[model samples]
Target: RTNDAVKTKDAFRNQAARLGFGTPNLLEATEYPLTRLTQNWQLLNSLYRSHWIIRRIIDVVPGDMLKNWIKITSQMPPDALKRFDSQVR
Candidate 1:
């Protein structure tokens, strides 16, 4: 799971770099996706802490197009995508 998180973060950061958004801060960026992609869903399913995840998404993700990033990562499952959609909107 941690490996999944790292891969997701790397892919996201690389895309951001390609789009001239700059890479995510290594120290700060890892934890958010790291925790989210672990398949635990405990934090993702929460009400209050979900804010943190959303904020992280805003901070780390580049540009307005989010679905691109989701697709690029190829790490999020359908259920996770649904949760992300609801949380994002």
Candidate 2:
């Protein structure tokens, strides 16, 4: 699944490049800026969008949508105030 995700990302970058959208640099675990990206507002917003549109709305067949939402949200830290998993300090 991880490999499949990587391939999808690669395909997205390639397709974006082909379509004249500038391909933003891909983030990877080893990259020095990976942490910055993982904590980025834009990326987190996109993740939330995907969570809504893809995870819930599109994949309506999932048995436990709320649990799936929590699981996906908990994977990332509080990148933005809207992040589902977070604590106020």
Candidate 3:
């Protein structure tokens, strides 16, 4: 499921590029070593704090549900959506 999500995102990015829309490269934004370290540390800390609970959730939760939850929580703003729609069309 995670793989599917990644593939979908990549496909979207590729399509956007083909349509002349520029997508921000998150990796480039975090190119500084200190920034990367901070991000990694935060991820590690979060995992350390909820390792067991996260494991249980992953073991029990359906991938589709998790994907939907992520999408709902990470919705684009109206203006962004409008821009995306215009560019996509």
Go through the candidates in order and give the clash count of each. 0, 0, 0
How close is every model to the real structure, measured as TM-score?
Answer: 0.19, 0.18, 0.18
Q: Which pairs of residues clash in candidate 1, taking residues 3 or more apart in a chain or in different chains? A: none
Which structure among the candidates has the greatest lDDT?
Answer: 3
Task: Give the candidates in order of lDDT, highest first.
Answer: 3, 1, 2
Model 2: number of backbone collisions: 0
Candidate 1 vs candidate 2: the TM-score winner is: 1
- lDDT at position 10, candidate 2: 35
lDDT tens digits, residues 1-89, model 3?
Answer: 35544334433446444432366655446655444544686776787577998656655767656554422334789788777656754
Reference-based lDDT, each prediction: 0.57, 0.51, 0.58
Q: Which tens-of-lDDT digit does each residue in 1-89 have in candidate 2?
A: 35544333433336544442354544422355334554687876677576766446545556555544543434454566454355521
Per-candidate RMSD, Å:
23.7, 21.3, 27.0
User: Whose TM-score is higher: candidate 1's or candidate 3's?
Assistant: 1
